[model samples]
Structures are given as C-alpha cells and as structure tokens.
Target: MTAASRPKSVYPLGAKAVRILVADDHLVYRIGIRNLLGSEPGFDVVGEAADGLQAVELYRKLRPDVLLLDLRMPHKNGVEVVRAIRQEHQTARILVVTSYQTEEEVFQVLQAGAQGYVVKDVGRETLIEAIRAVNAGTRWVPPAIQKQFSDRVLRQELTAREIEVLRLLTRGLTNREIANVYGISANTVKNHLNNLMAKLDVADRTEAVSFCLARGIVKPEEI
Candidate 1:
C-alpha cells in the first residue's frame, strides 16, 4: 500500500474528545498550549494550573483524559503531582511536559508512573501526536531525546561518580586537583575521566568537557 493509504493510529474523528489539563508555571506557556490545542478538532482544554498543588486539585476535580505537566513548579513539582494522582487513579494518563531532559529528571518522573514523557522544545505536530498517543494508552518520547537516553543505556559509560568527575572536569580541573578536592586517589580520578570520555564519545579530557558542556551536562558558570 502507498504511504497515503497507511492507517492512522490516533482516534477517529468525532470520537470522544480528549479532555486535557494543562499545568505550567508560566502563564504564557499555558495560554499558548491552550490556544494550540483548543483549535484542534478532538482536543478539549478542560482545566489549567499554575503549580503542582493546583494541578493535583484540578486533576481531582476535572479528572481530565490527559495531564500535561511541568517538572519544576512552586508548591509542588510535577513528579510529586504525578505520584499523588497515580495513588488514587492508577489509570491516570500523565504526559510529563517539561524543559528538563536530564537522565535523573526523566527517571524520577518515569518512576513516579508517568505514561508519556516529552520535552517542551518538541515541534507542534509531535506535541499533538504525543497527547493523542498518551491518551490512546501508548507512550511518547521525542525521537532526539529517545536517542540520547538509548545511547546512554547502551554505553553504560558514566556512573554517577563519573558524571561528577566530568562536571568537575568541565570546570577545568586537573585529575590531581580533582583527586585532592574529592579526597580520592589520582588514579581514581583518571579512571573516572576515561569512563566519561567513553560515555561522551570523546577522545580526550578537553573533548569530553566540551561534549558535556554542549549537551547541558555542565552549567556555563561551572566552566
């Protein structure tokens, strides 16, 4: 069959519109998302919250078909809200919508029972697809971010300790200096550096540091 004749995976038109609860600290972001989905044929923007506490309250009251939640918010974080909503409503369809793409942050939300995870920078069509996919009892992760995590999982290059070492390395610290600061042997520091290089796909310390900085593994001020 031709690509144009391929079956679509999303719900059919005129189906039960997916009710969405949007939660974000920024008013502009919330408004933007509301406007975007509001125009879509099968989406109903039911409720909105400015923080995690409000999100939980709205989730209870609105019981929307899907919850688009931010990670960092005042009063409570998205992870806490996800855990809270999941406690009583095991079938809660929550798609973590956040700017954070770090491994630790993603792991925390996933462990808390998020059905779908997507980053904010995803394109409009992909964002809508994510909402529909999550509502349809499937998970959605942006391709780029998925590749990032998949590579990390496959390489198994950086332990938590190695990440720390790379962070310090980005600060332009020498191995001996890092050893002195962390109270570890110089050889241990060197070992951590080697592991970080492998994980970062870099050949040397400078390349590893550059890779980490480029990928947001290190803050600008840390350099």
Candidate 2:
C-alpha cells in the first residue's frame, strides 16, 4: 500500500505497545518494514517518512517510541537527521536500518546519537530484537558491526583538513588545485595528503581515494 493509504496507527494487541516511525527513501522498503513490524505482537507502526526531512518532521509530530531510520536519504542524511532529532528531543530512541555497513557510516550515526545500527539484510528476528532493545533504552550494535567499529576506533583518525583534502582528491583535483582551494601551499597540500594516506593505511593518493570510496568515507555523489 502507498504510504498515504496506509493506516496511520496500528492498534496494539498487547499491553504497552512500542510505537514506531518508519523512515526510508524507498516506498517498497517502507511498506515492507511496516508490514513486518505490524505482524509483531507489541509493535504499533505509527507513521512513515519518505525522506530525511519528512522523517524529522514526522518524529516531531508522532513522537514514536522508536524510529527506524535509513542512512541515505534526501534533504538530510541519517547523521543529520539523528543530530536534528536529538537536538530537540534528547531521549529519542533511533535505530538505523540501512544497507550501508561501512565503519564510517556506522560510527557517524552512532556518534550523532542513534541508539542502534543494523544492516538491512539482518534476519527478521534480529531486526525485531534490535527495535525492542533500543526501545528499552539499550544500545544495540550487531557483533560483526561492533567488531568493525572497534577496529576503526583503534586506528588513527584523519584530521578535518586531511578529510577535506581527501574529498578533493576524489574529485580528481591536483595538489596545486587543492592547495589553491584551501589557500595553502602545494607543499602543505602534499603534507595533508601524506598524513591522510598514512592514517588510511594506503600507499599513495590514488590508493587513499580508492580506500575512502570503498569504505564509504567519501561518497561519489559528494565528489
């Protein structure tokens, strides 16, 4: 069913139902999630949002007990949405359900105050468990995701300037062009590149860009 035609609230058949707001860019995914959650005993799928902005807006209106958010949405990405919602409602329970599994994506959303992160391909039971866990004020990160996140935490982090340089590198900018963009010398740009490459554990600029792209640290559209 279309989001517009779907029931605004599914009455709970059990005591103390968990109200949920589903947000994703894809209509099919939203419908699928709504159906899946609606089948559970204590779930009340209260609303649906088709994009990040709508997600934020709906959260304000519905105030669901749990929000199932997708990481990549128009108007605002998951990180931005989490930060926006948490800024207004510190106790908001958000669970990121997305296909993106890159360490950077997971870390960014969690840092922005998401209570849980689960890949889209997780089993139905796991997804339901995560929602329930987050609703009960617990942080949920699957074992594999937690391990990758831990590994990323142990590695050296890239400085803001270094990350900026990396983005420019992905755009195929030359050292001179990048330096000019930042009002720095070519030598300074080279220094940033070298530092970023070291932190990323890549051999050269090309490898650094490739690594960032592969790891979802720098998205192609952002370039």
Candidate 3:
C-alpha cells in the first residue's frame, strides 16, 4: 500500500495527537508509560498520576481522550477512578493495565465503565491498538481477560478448592469420599461445603448441590 493509502485514524488530517492520561503508583512505571505513548506518532501523554485520586483529578482538569490506568493505585484504586470519571462524564474512555487481571478485578473495572482491559505484558503494538480502539468508541480486551470476565458472569464466586468439592458433590460423594479425593480431612471438606453453601446462598448441602447443578456449575462427566 502506498503512504497515501495507509489506514486512517480518528484524528482529522493535521489534527492534534490523541491526548492520554496515565495513572500508576510507581513513578518509574508512570514515566515509562508516558515516554512510550509520548514517542508514538499520533498519541500524546498529557498527564500522569501516581494514585487513583490524583488520576481522577487530573482527568477532570485535562479531559484527555483516553486514560491509561493501573488497578492497584492508592486512595481510590482503578475501579473507583473509572466509576468516578464515568459518573461525571458518561463518555469517558478508560483502559486498565495492571499486573494482575483476576476475574474479580476485570469484572469490577469493566462494571465501572472501563472500555479496555489488558495486562502490563502486552506488546507495544497491542497496547497501541487497544488505546486506539478504545478511543474510537470500541471495547477492547485480551482473550484471557474476556474468558475470565465471562466466567465471572456465568458462575458464582467460589474458591478453586470449593469448586473441586462441588464437582465431587455432583457424583454423590460423601464428605469422607471427597476428602479422600482431595487428600484433605473430612472436617476440611465440611468447611469447604459450608463456604460453598454460604457463597451460593443456599441453606443446606442438598440445596447447594442443586444450585450448582441448575447453574451448570459442575457437569456430571466432569466428576
């Protein structure tokens, strides 16, 4: 393709670069992100913050087109920041880049109106595409993040061990049988069952098992 036939951007010909605000607790990380995005051709790092509250304040003052946020900043955290900004400006474009992308974390931030979610390990090209996509009114997330988000929506929250126990429950396993499967004591199995019941909001073991079955939390063949 010729240079004149290259892909387009949201920016008009000879328009300003896309403004960006970055929020991270680590100064070095913040600086690195600033430089990385700043050096790009069509992007500009307009502001940077070391904490969530500062991120919110800077976003308000700068009103950048996009926000690159960290999940674990002090004061408010990335979720709270996303919530605050989207509350004030419904069209706010925010992206969360964090070291950890647990199901809960992805659910919280996306629920709070973040448009893009990615880990810090993403390549520069991927990050740039994510930022551009988000700025252009698109939602962007990695495959693994999408899977985690789907799991959060589809399944009730339970510990890994609790799910293991629940799977065994589907097979008519007694507490002792489940204990033998996991090599845990029967009391530990009982405790896991109790936690699962509470998390599933059920009254008893039978109800808990029924809830899991109804929700397809555990398949029969999986046990």
TM-score of each: 0.63, 0.64, 0.68
Residues 1-223, model 2: lDDT tens digits = 5544544433445579899999999999988998887776688899999999999999999999999999999999999999999999999999999999787898889889999999899977789889989999999998888866755663437777887898999889999999999999999999888887777778999998887787667778878
User: Per-residue lDDT for 1-223 in model 3, tens only?
Assistant: 4334544344466867889999999998988787676556789898889899999999999999999999998999889999999999999999898998877889999989999998998877789899999999999988877866765665656888999888888788999999998888999999999888877788988898787776667766677
For model 2, give the 10-residue run with minimal summed lDDT.
3-12
Off by over 4 Å in 3: 1-13, 156-169, 172-216, 219-223
lDDT of each: 0.83, 0.88, 0.86
Query: What's the lDDT for residue 174 in model 3?
Result: 96
Candidate 3 matches the true fold with a TM-score of 0.68
Higher-lDDT candidate of 2 and 3: 2
Instruction: Find the 10 residues in a row with the least total lDDT in model 1.
Output: 1-10
TM-score winner: 3
- Candidate 1 Cα errors over 4 Å, as ranges: 1-13, 147-223
Q: Cα miss at 124, model 3 (Å)? A: 0.6
